[model samples]
Target: MKETYEEKINRRLKVKQRIIEVAAGREKADLVIKNATYLNVFSNEFLQGDIAVANGLIAGIGEYEGEKEIDVNGKIVLPGFIDAHIHLESAMVTPSEFAKAVISHGTTTVITDPHEIANVMGLNGIDYMIESTQNLPVDVYFMLPSCVPATAFDESGAGLGYKDIDSYFEHKKVLGLAEMMNYVGVINGDGDVVSKIIASQAHHKKIDGHAPELSGNDLNAYIAAGVYSDHECSTFENALEKLRKGQFIMIREGTAAHNLSALMPLLTKQYSDRCMFATDDKHPSDLLNGGHIDYIVKQALKNGADPIVTLKAATHNAARYFLLNNKGAIAPGYLADIVVADNFADFNVEMVFKRGKLIFDGEVKEFDAPSVDETLVEKCHNTFNLDEVTPNSFKVDGKLGLIGLVGGELLTRNLGFADKTDVENDILKIACVERHKNTNHIGVGYVKGYSLKSGAVATSVAHDSHNIITIGCSDTDIAVAVNAIRKAKGGIAVVENGEVKALLELPVAGLMSEEKLETVNEKLEKAKAEAYRLGADKSIDPFMTLSFLSLPVIPSLRITTKGVFDVEKCELLKDEMSV
Candidate 1:
C-alpha cells in the first residue's frame, strides 16, 4: 500500500524524534558541538556556548552533554545565513550543486525567485526546483514568480496568471509572491497587477517589489499597492524612502550589481532591523570566490557597519520579514541551522549545520542529492528560428540610444543620441534574437558608448525573457555569435575576429546548467578569463551585465528582440541616439 505525502512526512518526523530520544539516553547526540561562540541575532549578543543536536532539530543548545562533542574552541557560531532574494538558476547549477558550494560558506537557507525558469518552463520548472530541493540538507523556500516576462513589452517562454499563482501557493514550500517586476502596473493601477497581489494576500503571502525607477509619487503608489520588500534601491535617498515607507530594503550583492557598499551607510544599529542582504543573481564564479550571503556580510563590515548589525540583516531581519519561524535564529524550537565562523568579518565557515545534521564541515559530506533527469534537460529545447537569416542581419542605420551599464548597480545610465548616422569610430550595435520561440524577430539598433572593438558577444542568459542578446562592432561576429549560441542549445558565447573566445553552456532551460556546481564554477571562471582575453575589462563578470542589457523593465536604454526601448517612456525606437 502506498502512503500519502503527509503520512510519509509524519512517519519521518516520528522516526527522527525516536532516534533523538534514544541518543539522549546514551549521553550521545547525533552531533555534539562544543566551545562555540554564538551570534544571537535576536538579542545582538555573542555567547560562548555548546549546541547539542539529536535528530534534525536543535534538541538542546547551551552547555550540553552528548555522545560526540567536537570542540570548536576558537570559532564564532552564527545562525546560518539566509539569502532573502536569489534566482537559483542564475548560479548555473541545480539546488544540490549550489548547496555544496554555499554550505561551506555558511549559507543554510535561500529564498529563491525561480522566475528565470518560470519564464522558460513555467510551473514545471518551479516543480523541478521544489522536487530537487526536497531531500537536500539545506533549507530553500520559494516565492511564486510575480512577473513572468517581468514586463508586457518583452516575450518569455511562458506566462502564469492569477490562477496559476493561486494553485502554486498551495504548495507548502511556496513562501510568498516574488518581486513584482510590474512597477508601472502597480503605480498605474493595472487590473492584472492588483489582482495578483490580492491573490497572494488572500493566501496570506507577502508581496515582493521591484521598483527600479520609482520615486516620489510613483514610489508611494507602489508601497500602497502592497509590495513589502524591494532590492532595487540604487541610491541612499531611494533606499531611505523605501525603508521609511515600511518596506524591507534588501541590500543586494550579485554578479551584475554590487550595492552593499552604497547601501551599507543606511544600516545603523537602529535601522538595521529593517534591512536585509540578498544575492539577487549570483553567478557560479562569484559564489565560489566571495560566497552567497557571506559576501554581503563581509562587505557590510568592511564598510564600517556594525558586525552584529550586518549579521542581523543577513539572518534575523530576513527570516522575520519572510516569516520563516523555524530557521534564522539560534533560539529553542528553531531548526538547528547554524554556522561556526572564526570571525564575522572573514566569515570563514568552519562548520555548518542544517536541521541539526552536519552537512558541511568546510566541505561536502555524504551529500546524496538526486540526479537531474530528462524533464530538467528536455526543458531547454525552446524554439529557435533562423529563417530570417541575412549575412549582415544586425546592421542598423543612424544614431541610437545606448543603455550604459553602471558597474555594481541595477540602475543603467540612459545615454541618448550616442551616435548620429553611425559614425566610423562611434558606431555601437545592439541585437536581440528570440531564443525561446524561434521567432525571426531579431531587433537591431545602433548604440553609442558601449564601445566594442570588432567582435560580437551573444548570450541566451538575457534576464526575465532569456532571449539571445548580441552586441558587437562587426555584423559577421554578431551573426556568428547568435548562430553559435543556437548550436550549443543555450549558453553565453563571445565571437571576435571569426573565432569563439568563450562560452558557458546553460543546458537547463538555456539559463542554467545540469552539471555539478564545481564544474559550473570552473567553466564560469574560464569564461570570464576568456572575456578578459577578448577585451572585456569593465567588471568582474561582464556576462551578467550582458544579460541585463535585454531587460526592458529597468530604466533608460534597453533592447528586446523586438526593438530598442526607452524604458522610462516604455517605447521601442529605431535608434538610441535618436532618443
Candidate 2:
C-alpha cells in the first residue's frame, strides 16, 4: 500500500509542526549536542550554542532540551564537508566502499559525475551508479555525464547525445549536466552540445564546465553557453579570469592534478564565496592516506588561510553552488549534517552525524549495500569487447610524435618527433587499443618522461574513454600487458619478460572494483611498487599518470584509437613529422 499524495503532505506538515514546537521549547528534540562552538556560515564566525535535531532536521541552534544529549565541551562543530566535484570510479572501488572511506573523514555529501563509467556502458552505467548510491549515509548526488565519448576523435563504448540524457535532469539525485569538456563544440555551436546545454538550462539546472586554459572570447562564449562552473583551472590567473567572467572556480587537488597551491590565493574573503574545493579524481591510496574534503580544508588551514573562510568554501559555497539550500548550514529547518572536531589546528574529526544520526565515531556505521540490478552488474563485468592482442598489434612504423609528460599535471606537451623508441633517453612505446567494439583499432605512439626501463604497464581505466592503454619498452611486454587486461575482462596489469608482475582487477565496468577500499589500495600499492621497481618516475603516481595520456580533451598532444592526436588542431597526425 502507498500513501496518498494528500496523506504524504499531511505527514510532512505534522513533522514540520513538531520541528516548530521543538524550536519554540514546547516539545523535546530527538537529539541535542550541548556546549558546541559551531560555524555560522551566513555570518562567517564561530558562535557558541546547543544544536537540537528532530525528524532528521535541525530543529534549533540554542539552549534546548532533548531526548538524548551528547556533550562536546571543547570541540568545534561544523557543517559536514561537501565535495563539489569528484569521480567515484577513480577511487577504483564501488560507491558503497567509497562512502565508507569518506564518511570517517567527515564528508557527508559528494556531487559526482559518472562520465567515467558512462563512457563504458552509457545509460546503463549511469543507472548503475545511481542505484548503487541509494540509501547511503553520505548524500551522493550527480551531474549527468555531458560528454560520454568526450569528443568525436575518441572511441568510447557508448556515445550519449543531448536526447539520450535530457530526461535525467528530472531525476531527484541528479543536479544538472556534468563537466562540458567539449568547449570547442559549445563555442562553435555544435548542434548536439548546444542542445544539451539548452535542455539543462530549460530544466534550470547548473551546468558544470571543464575548459582548461581557455581565455578571451572563447571563455566568454563557453560561459555564454550556460556553463556555470569549471574544475580545470590550473593557474591562478586563469582561475581569476574565469572568476571575473562570472564563473565559479572549482579548485582541484587530486591524486594527479594539484591545482590547490596555485589557486590558494583565491581563498580570501573577496573570492571564497564563488570558490569550492574538488578532488576531481582521487585514487584509493590517496583516500586512505590523506582523506576527502577534510584533507583539502586542512591543507588550506596549514597554508595560513582564514579558517572560517576555508570552512565556508568546503560547505556553504558548494551547497549554494549546487542549490542544496538545506545543507551547508547548522540553522533551523536545515538537514542535521554535522561534524565534531578537536580543533582547527589539528582538524582531527572525532565524530560525524548525517541527518541527526551519529554514523561515525571512530568506526563507520554499517548499513546494507545498495542493491543494483544483477543484469546491469553482469553487463558491466562483460565490458571488454576485445579478446586478445599480439606483439604485431603494437607496431607503428613511421616518424612518431611524442607526448611529453609534465610532472604533477594532466597537461602534456608535444616533444616534436622521434624515429623509434629511445629507451636509453627514457622514451617508451605507448598504445591505446579499442576495447569497446573490438575493431582492432590500436593507436601506437611513443611517450617521454615515464622512464620505464624494463616492464610494461596497462590499464582499462583510460580517461574519457576507458580503452586499454599500455606502455612499455618492448613490443612483447606491451602485448602481454594488454592481453592480461583483456583476459581479466577489465583491470590494470604490469608485465615484464612476457609475464605478469602485478595486477589489480577492476571487474566493474573495467573502471572500478567492488572490493573494499583497503583491499583495492593494497593491490594498487603492489602494482605501483612493481612499476617503480621497473624505473617509473618516483615523483608522480605512475598508474594515475598513465591513465590520462589518452584523454584528448586536455591539451597539447594525446593518443586515441586512431593515432597520435593534435588536440589544438583537432586532427590525427600522419606524415607531418619526419626524422
Candidate 3:
C-alpha cells in the first residue's frame, strides 16, 4: 500500500506516543543498537546503553527489547555531525554528488545556502537545490538567499526580493534566511533587505549574518537586525566578539580560507557552546583529501578541546544554534542520526545511521563509491550566454587599483599600480565577464600575489553571480581560457602558451558539474596542477580563489560587470584611474 504524507508522520507520531510502552518492554522497538558507549551530549557523559530506534526517532534507552538489534561491540556512539553553514555549489558538484562525498565522512545534516544558484536563476534555482537533494543519506536544509546579486556594484542573472523569499519559505526544507551579506544594507536599513529580514522574522525564522571585521556600533546595529548566526568570522577577536554578542560563531575552515588554527586557540570549554564548526565554501578536492565536519572534530580534539566538548561543537551546538528540532542529540525524542567510531582522536567512522537507517557501514577507510542518480542529471544544464572575445577585450593599461589576494583569505587589499610595470613584479590583469547576458560587460583590473609568471586561469563559478572571471599575465592566454570556458558552457580552464592545458566543466548554472566526485577530483586536480605550473601561489587553491574575486562584498577591492568597488566605502573605485 502506498503511504500518504499524513500517514507517514502520523505513524512516526504514534511511535513517539508509545515510547513509554517500548521502554517498559510492553511494545517492541523497531531497532536497537546494543552495548554501545554513547556520548550523551546533554549531560556530557559517556554511558553504556542500548539505543532504541523506532519510526526514525529514538524511542527508548538502557536495556531494551527490539524486533531487531545489532551489537555495537563497545564502540563509541555520538550524534551524527552537522555542517551549520556551507555553500553546496562551491563543491563544484550537484547536491546529490556532494551528499555522496560527505555522508561517509559522518555528516548527517547540512544547512546549505543556495545563494550561489539563487543569484543566477532565482527561485527556480533554489527549488532545484531543494528537490534534487531529497531522499539522500544525509538531510539537507536550506537558508533563503538574502542577497541574490550579493551587491549593487556587481551584476547577477537574477535578484530575489521579499516576494521571492516568501515563496521560498513555503518550502518545508527552507529553515530561514541565508547570510545577510549586505551588512551595509542591514546597518543602514535598505528597503528590500529590511523587508526580507522582517519577512523572515514574521515567519519566525532566524537570520544568518555576514559582517567581516565589523565591530562596535556597526556590529551592534547588525545584531539589532536579528541576525542570529555568523559563519564569516575569520579571526579570533572577531569570533570572540560575535560570541559575546550572543551570536553563534561558526568557525569556518575551507579550501580557500583556513581559519581553524587561528580560531581554535579560542575554543575553551567555557565558550564551546557558542562556537560551532562549518566549511562554508569547501572544494570537493579538499573534502576528498581531508573530510567534512569529522575532520574539524578531529582537529578540535587535537587542538586540546575535551573530546566530549569538541564533539558537542561539531554536533549539538550547531543543531541548537539553528533551532533544528529533534536533531544533534541522543535523546528519546531526537532522530537516530548517529555515528559509531573506534576512537575520538582521528576518529574513524565504523557505522553511520540517519533517521534510524544505516547509510554507511564498516570502517570509513572501506568506503564504497556512490553513483549519481541519472534522473538528477537533467538539472545539470548550461547557463552561460556570452560569445567569444578577443585578446583585446582583456587589455588593461594606465593607473589601476590592484586587488591584492591574501593567501587563504577572503579579504583583498586595494593596492595602487600606476602602470603596467608591475607585471614584471608579478601583478596580473583580471576581468569579470558578464556571461549571463551578452551585454559584453567586462570589468578589468589588476590583481597581485597570484604569482602567475605565465598563462591564465578562468572559471564561470564566480560567486553569487556565477559570471566568468579570468586572470592572466598574457591577454592572449586570458582570451584563450575565457573562450574555452564559453565553449564548455561552464567550467574552469587553464590556458598556457595560447593553448588549453586543462578544463573541468560545470554544466549546472555554470557552477556545478554532473561528474562523480572521484572523476571530478581527477579532472580538477589536473586543472589545478596546470594552474600551479602557470605560477599560482602554493598557499592557495588557484581556481577557488579566482571565483571570489568578483564578490564585491568581502573587502578592499572587488570587480563586477560595472567596475571595481571599494566594498567598505560602498562606492565605485572608478575615480582612482580607469584602465
**Whole-model lDDT values for every prediction:** 0.77, 0.93, 0.84
For model 3, residues 300-361, the per-residue Cα lDDT tens digits are: 78888788888888899989987887999998889999999888765887789888888788
TM-score against native, each model: 0.93, 0.99, 0.94
Cα RMSD (angstroms) for every candidate in the order listed: 2.8, 1.0, 2.8
Which candidate has the top score in TM-score?
2
Query: What C-alpha lDDT does candidate 2 achieve relative to the native structure?
Result: 0.93
lDDT of 2 by residue, 339-397 (tens): 99999899988999999999999999998899999999999899988857888888777
Question: How many clashes show up in model 1?
Answer: 10
Lowest-scoring 10 consecutive residues by lDDT in candidate 1? Answer: 417-426
In angstroms, the error of model 1 at 146 is 1.3
The better-scoring model by lDDT among 1 and 2 is 2
Clashing pairs in 2: none
